[model samples]
Target: MLLVLAATGALRGVLDLRTPLVVTILANLLNIALNLLLVHGFDLGIGGSAAGTAIAQWAAALCLVAVVLRRARAAGSSGRPDVAGVVAAARQGVPLLARTATLRAALLLGTAVAATFGDAPLAAHQIATSLVSFLAFALDAVAIAGQTLTGRTLGAGDAEGTRALTRRMIVWGLGTGVVAAVLLLVLAPFVGGWFTPDATVHDALVPALVVVALVQPISGVVFVLDGVLIGAGDGVYLAWAGLAVLVAYAPLALLAGSLGAGLAWLWAAYGVFQLARLVTLWLRQRGDAWLVLGA
Candidate 1:
């Protein structure tokens, strides 16, 4: 995971997104093949599945690293790590880590609440969350573009360029969000059966899926602004803002759980969380403070 992450980050810095995407696809294909071979052929069970994934990840990481090294060689770059630069980069990353951790904590809280509602609710929660997570990758593609371009634009001290990029990405994010929302809603009835044959779980899932579908636009804005702020090196603000939203969200989630609310309500609480995120990020994007121009 670490090696792949490093390689992807380096590739993103050079605006080489295709390599990471290709390697990821190859890795998943390799993982499926290895899992079939190890788990069934060798009868290694779950441990074999784990081993297959581990091997696939390592293979992908090595492939990406080789590509990075070759690129460096071609560019005549030293490929040597500078201690001071490393320290500075790590320092900058700390707030990002905090921001991510807080966001994940909120998700965990939702999962915990879902588990309290019993098997069917929990299953529905899992399915809905998984579907939303899958959709997030598509929406996040625009955010990735925003992040890369915003960083490059800001680094060159082009404030107007940064704003222009943000606006363009926001439009893309909204358009993608609308498409996802429409598709999710249109498929909500039939989608649950695809994941499970259990009628109770499927019935429980549709309402929550609808809630998820309704919030795609909010999610879209939140993700893009998040990437934009990160590109601007505004991690400290992001960390604090994320923590604030989590704090605000916890009570809402708890209340829904305590009231024995249905899956839809619980997911509604998550929608509130996303709304909070949108508010914070939107406010930041409106201001000039996040446009810190420099390396």
Candidate 2:
């Protein structure tokens, strides 16, 4: 499963991820069907789940390959990787690679910190993580929309249109975040019960979820700004800014863990990190730095 996942993940690039996303959806649907058949009918259990996931990943990877090839052909280009092009692409991608690594490390470290708080806290953290992940992925569609549209407008040298589009995207992000927060807040009391049976875990989850709900607006702004910056080709700034955000988050995270403040405090630390991101990205948008016509 991990191997297949890595292969498919490599094909995921650019702001326009529609093809890969559709492939993933189809693959996951197949995985669900296979898991039901193999886990129940064939009695393979956990192994069946792993096998299903692996097959789905492979399917997605294949579909991604097909999509890339088709697009290349449609552009009337030779579908072959050139060494010079590959090297240039790799050079451009270095900062993004570093940024992704740091982000992953922070999340892993956060999970480790959660485990130190005991089973109930860890379980509650998992539930909150799941909810956050779902919301993040959903919100990302809007971010993607912002990225593709903004990139196109800027590339066309339409400064006014780009600004208008950015404003619209920001509004979209704000609106989506607020709606998500309200829904989560309204459902917070009962959501935990759906995920776990232990009263202790459920109790720990409510406040954590409330924290999640409250932070949604902040997260929405950060995520949209992140996509907008990427669209504007601000990779170098983003990479460094991500490192700075991580540095800012580290102290708060350490204090949260050291003080034994549990999941709510930990999430509050995450909120701080997102706030830092929002500020940094907003600052970048205030200048003509990214309006370079040829860049």
Candidate 3:
């Protein structure tokens, strides 16, 4: 999985976004076909679903690596590995690893808390979160753009250009998010039906979906600023900020669970998590410390 991500990032680093995008789309299509074949044709059930996904991801990674190597060869890039450069890159990635770890931990906490509310709430939580993830992936395109563009501009030492790019990306993120929210709102009542036939889960999910819709704009800002900081090589601050947001979120999630609140309140707690991230990133963006002027 990490290899898949690394290959995708490497492609993106060279501004070859279309390759990864096309590769991912094809991989997803292959994944669906394999899942049907393995699960239904082979009768492997849930394990087959997992296997299909793994196979698709591995295929995607290998395809991407081949493309990258082909490009490298075409560019006449042939040399011994730079051990020192590799070490520096690894060091720079550590804080990002930490940040991602903590953020995932918080997500796990939310899932755990949701489970305490019984099967219906847990199912509803799952549906709502799946939608959130789907929307996030779409919105994250803006963040990816921010990451690529911000790095290029800052690497060129164009401070004003970086700021202008940042502003433009933020606005784009917010606008995309608003459109998503509206669509989600319009679809909330019917979406759960597509996922499950259980009336209890379906009804319980509506408010949760509403909560998810309401948080989209906040999510937009959080994702964009996060990418901007990452592009600026400000991962250390991101690591700490992620920790702080997790700390702030745990209690709220726990409180909602203990109060026997439904899925919506639990999701509201997640909103607080996004809001905390927006606050930290907003503050960081307001300063020039992350504006390192060179590659």
Give the top-scoring candidate (TM-score).
Answer: 1
TM-score of each: 0.95, 0.87, 0.91
Candidate 2 collision pairs: none
Which lDDT tens digits does candidate 1 get at residues 23-108? Answer: 99999999999999999999999999999999999999999999999999899979998799899889999999999999889889
Taking all chains together, the TM-score of candidate 1 against the true structure is 0.95
lDDT tens readout by residue for model 2, 187-287? 99899888877999988888888988999998887778878777777788889988998999888888888889999999888888778888988998878
Question: Against the true structure, whose lDDT is highest?
Answer: 1
Local distance difference test scores for all models: 0.93, 0.81, 0.92
Report the lDDT tens digits of candidate 3 across residue range 1-295.
7777877887888788999889999999999999999999999999999999999999999998889878888888774576997898899899999999988898899999999999999999989888988999999999999999888999999999999999999999899989989999999999998998999998889999999999999999889999999998999999999999899999999999999998899999999999999999999999999999984
Q: Is candidate 1 or candidate 2 better by lDDT?
A: 1
The C-alpha RMSD of each candidate to the native structure, in angstroms, is 1.6, 3.1, 2.3
